[model samples]
Target: MIYVNEAADPRLDDFRDLTTADRRPDRPGGRGLVIAEGTVVVRRLLASPYRPLAVLGVRRRVEELADDLAELTVPAYVTSSEVMAAVVGFHLNRGVLAVADRVPPPTVESVVADARVLAVLEGVGDHENLGSLFRNAAAFGVDGVLLGPGCADPLYRRSVRVSMGNVLRVPFTALPDWPRALLGLRRRGFTVAALTPRPDAVDLRRLPDGATGRVAVLLGSEGHGLSEQAIAAAELAVRIPMAPGVDSLNVATAAAVAFYELTALAHPGHPAIATPRPRQRTDGGTVGQ
Candidate 1:
């Protein structure tokens, strides 16, 4: 609960300018600290395993976190928003920031060890999309995320903000060996479904029963869709039905829909996504596998 009034205070260095925030990546340490902006995200950072080094904010913003900060071991640097912006090199409308070292990402095997429904992503380099995907996954009760390739760092400041800090709670991992890693998932009883817009793909509602054990939805970036190697590695190419000529949904939105369908089956009692209500397919038959 220490109130810091000076920007020159040595205790505030960890919360310094964003211009060089990423610069530390080239330093001997070779990595930048995790930064959480806004009160919501900052509160999440404080709760995460990553040890909070310091908190910087205007008085009011820091006060919002007083409940969490009561027994916090870190210092809270309070300042005017103008002074805060001058030190941080931009006018951060969030009015607060917290810095913490990153925790290690989980191993792919561990992330999927007990996963009933997981989301594996490829070429998802946009931070906001990545964050939104995590939030959607959490809302739909997805178990985890496995990064296939070209995925952005989920702990990046913008990702943390956009996720509303859900990134701090959802566990994720980097799956090595590219598409080859998908084999390892299958070995553990996961039926990997690559979501794509290709018409020849099986309609989501008509997916096979093999998806029961441990299901994983393989996702791709919105721009180009899944890579050939990804599609080739999957057990099924699944497509969500949309009106003709409607193209597809946002990557995160698509994840939400697929997660809702898959996870509802995996965990029957989960309430947010109720049991699927039978609906007609475009061909005029009862839906759901």
Candidate 2:
């Protein structure tokens, strides 16, 4: 590991000016490089599929990640906090920073094959919401995430930090199949439940009755909720009962509540084994592109 005292070191370009460096390429003044701040996230990124370009930090922070950095063939630029802040444009309390190219996730079918409860997202462009969904999914025993249509990348720097690096731990796949692709899940005996606030829809608590096989929960963007196509494709639509009219919880918060209810419904021990849930049909074909 080669170390440098100057923040101007040419080898350290990847970790420079992180505050605005992570913006999308399409956005004005954006480089779109995948960035990871803090020791934990940087370490995960190094371990992830994305190849590490370089790392920059103060001496203490770099030393703290010595174990993680041991296998890397990249440069480790060590400098004073003053220099680091100046070069990065903003003071990063996390101390360490690593940058790498974005590595896309796998396709839909492989991600769903061995999963139980999967979270399918559509039009969830909010990074924080997406990250929180992955964190909640991991906490409640959900296996993987399927980016149905418009979900943002879970590997984005902010998402990684918000998820506390759980995004690296949980696998995610992008599904190009819109509503039509859900047919593949049906073939796998998955009862697709779209989480909505519709009154006529089945109650969220009423699920898991005979759900012995796989299941997928479809969620939509924060602004407009699920698309009509997504809702119509699912076997049933369910919603959480709130006090009178509490508008609705944030997408991630709503997901947490739904997860809690779903998990309880699935593992309700002795007294709840006999509850009757909507019948699950193993219908449809393999997911097509």
Candidate 3:
């Protein structure tokens, strides 16, 4: 561990002025760095395929990650909280931060090759909503995510933080040619089911038996929903039933509901959707399994 007394130290450049545009990897003049905040997210970054360049935190937070750091040869910068705040351009309550270079993303074919359930997104420009969708995908065991078009970069800093770092865990790839690209998924035996709120759409709970086979749930931005062409390209359209006054749900919430339903359908008896077994006493002990 290196104790740096000055915030101006050259080694701390990767973490300097994080809020500025130049540090935003998704924008022009950006370094394209993958940053992880807090001990939990930092630990996840360390475990991810991305190679850690450096770690900066106060002494206590640094000590908390001692074991994770021990396995790495990267520099761990231990500094005072005041210095850390000054270096990062804000008071980061998470205390610890790690930055790594972005790695090449997997191709659509690779991510879909062996997947059973997938989440396909279009025009989901909001980073927070995209992040929450990724978190939900991870929660429900979604095999992968396919970005159809106009989706935000899942590795953006806000997305990484909002997702509680699940973005690092879930595999994702970009789909080419917009709605037309969906045909590739179909050829691979995936039934592309688009989620929409149209009255004529099939109820989400009553999905056809064929939907239980390798399925891809196509979701769109909440404001406009899926484009007509996108919906028409899908094998079927499904909707979550709501009250008369409610017309739609936030994109992330809607994605979560769809993911749960589709994943449960695809993998019956999964822990998340399975009914809990009643406990009964056996000859030697209580049993539930």
- Highest TM-score among the candidates is held by which one? 3
Q: Which tens-of-lDDT digit does each residue in 1-289 have in candidate 2? A: 4567777776776666666566666643454666778888888878887787888888888898898888778777878888888788888898888877766567676788787778889998988998898889777767788887878878776787888777876779888768888877878888888999888877776665655456788999878999999999998898888788678789998888877666545444424322333455568433332
lDDT of 1 at 96: 88
lDDT tens string, model 1, 210-265? 87567989999999899999999999999999989896799999999898788877
List ranges where model 1 is wrong by over 4 Å: 26-29, 276-289
- What TM-score would each prediction reach against the true structure? 0.90, 0.83, 0.91
Error of 1 at 16 (Å): 2.0
Query: How does candidate 1 fare on TM-score?
Result: 0.90
Q: Residue-wise lDDT of candidate 3 within 140-174, one digit each (tens)?
A: 88999999788998888889999889899999988
List candidate 3 stretches off by more than 4 Å: 21-31, 269-289
Candidate 1 achieves a global lDDT of 0.85
Scored by lDDT, the top model is 3
Model 2's lDDT to the true fold? Answer: 0.78
